[model samples]
Target: MNETIRALLSKLGGLPMPVADLADDADLYAAGLSSFASVQLMLGIEEAFDIEFPDNLLNRKSFASVAAIEKTVAIIVDGRKVA
Candidate 1:
């Protein structure tokens, strides 16, 4: 999952540095993730994970960092399993 997230970031993050070089807790916005890029990243995430983010999760906090994104995806994926 982490690798996948990193791959998505590498492809869509538009960061000045490589996503693989950033720490899990690194602030993506600070690393140059613009709002447009975040939206693109979100789309990539949805496609890659096969999960649509809930409306409640559509916010800056949910995409704050790699760890945050991982947590959000885990929640959605786990919820799907229970349903």
Candidate 2:
């Protein structure tokens, strides 16, 4: 599975979702995503990727799109961060 799908699944928490059903350009928030779950999703992503989410990226806009999260993760992966 791609990082974006993985992140989305992790973000889903216990929502019983199907990652493959989501399109790359899918609207995560509108796709049954909740504010509380978003935070958990971020945490799940951080743990899965072993990268901390930057303060500047801690916003609804960042989590609004899977592509955006993938982009942010790419940036995080490109950068050298502490484990």
Q: For model 1, name the residue pairs that clash.
A: none
What are the lDDT scores of the predictions, listed in order?
0.93, 0.71
Output the TM-score of candidate 1.
0.95
Best by lDDT: 1
Off by over 4 Å in 1: none
Query: lDDT tens string, model 2, 55-80?
Result: 88898887776776788777777774
TM-score of each: 0.95, 0.75
Kindly state the number of residue pairs that clash in model 2: 0
Q: Report the number of clashing residue pairs per model.
A: 0, 0
The whole-model C-alpha lDDT of candidate 2 against the native structure comes to 0.71
Q: On residues 27-78, what C-alpha lDDT tens digit does candidate 1 reach at each position?
A: 8998999999999999999999999999999999989999999999999999
- Candidate 2: list runs displaced more than 4 Å: 1-4, 7-17, 81-83
